[model samples]
Target: MDEAAVKEFIGTEISRSTVVVERSAIAFFASAVLDDDPVYTNADEASARGFEAIPAPPTFPFVMQNWGAFAELQAEGGQGAGLGMVLGPLMANGGLILHGEQAFVYHQPVLAGQTLTGVGVIKDAYVKESKGTTMTFVVAETTWSDASGAPVVTTTFNIIHRK
Candidate 1:
């Protein structure tokens, strides 16, 4: 798609996935990132530090958002979908995908075993036309909320596609 077509998707809903935040997911993420914070995987340590449960690390929601991508991939019968899968359509042409920036805002602590739903939307899409090449900047945000519908986290992802 060209710039106009890409911009038309600015307000489109990309994906939504809900998962019951659990110990395994949190532990795995912490280990994979080499985060030594005990609060992310040990309930006892968290409680000792004044937390009611094993609290998710600050960047947990960002990783948790991948559930939506994986779900979409499964629906399409793809072999597998992990991180970075949400941008499948945009990257179909082998364009250079750069993770530009990321920001996070947390309204409340996300604890283990809490059912949370996250929805991703195309917040902004703009194209930078340069000589002989086109670059697109896509900013997507995912709002994660608890079962009661109260937003607990908001994450902004800035992705750049160069073709």
Candidate 2:
């Protein structure tokens, strides 16, 4: 995936002000991931455990920042293009897209019902030649914050588009 267009995405803020975090979203994500953590599903359990409400499990922020409003973000008037948009041009150029890596760091627990905002940027885009193959790597970082502007979680996504 050596298209110049894909390279232009480096440093681009692909997603901004993504969506708010809610209790239902947390519970659903927890269920989908088979977390089965009471803090993510039961408000009473979370409260008894010293949380104001059901607290999201780790990695919940990524769910809200990525798939939460992905449909809207990929369309016109949203970010330049969502993940799929970037993947298309890459795949068309004899490249294969793969999930390279992912990491998350939590500064604070994301509370249920708190309206949150997210921002993401294509941190880097580069090509590497190894094993007689040329591989393109795109790394993105998205941070979710609370209404008070305190960051809750920072997630880094690494994608490999290989040819």
Model 2 spans with C-alpha error above 4 angstroms:
1-8, 66-80
> Model 1: residues >4 Å from true position, as ranges?
66-92
TM-score: model 2 vs. ground truth: 0.82
lDDT of 2 by residue, 13-76 (tens): 7776656567788888899889987878888889889988788878777677544554553335
Which structure among the candidates has the greatest TM-score?
Answer: 2
What Cα-based lDDT does every candidate model obtain? 0.76, 0.77
Clashing pairs in 1: 21-113
Q: How far is candidate 1 from the true structure (C-alpha RMSD, Å)?
A: 4.4
lDDT (0-100) at residue 144 of candidate 2?
A: 78
Q: What is the number of backbone collisions in each predicted candidate, taken in the order shown?
A: 1, 0
lDDT of 1 at 130: 89
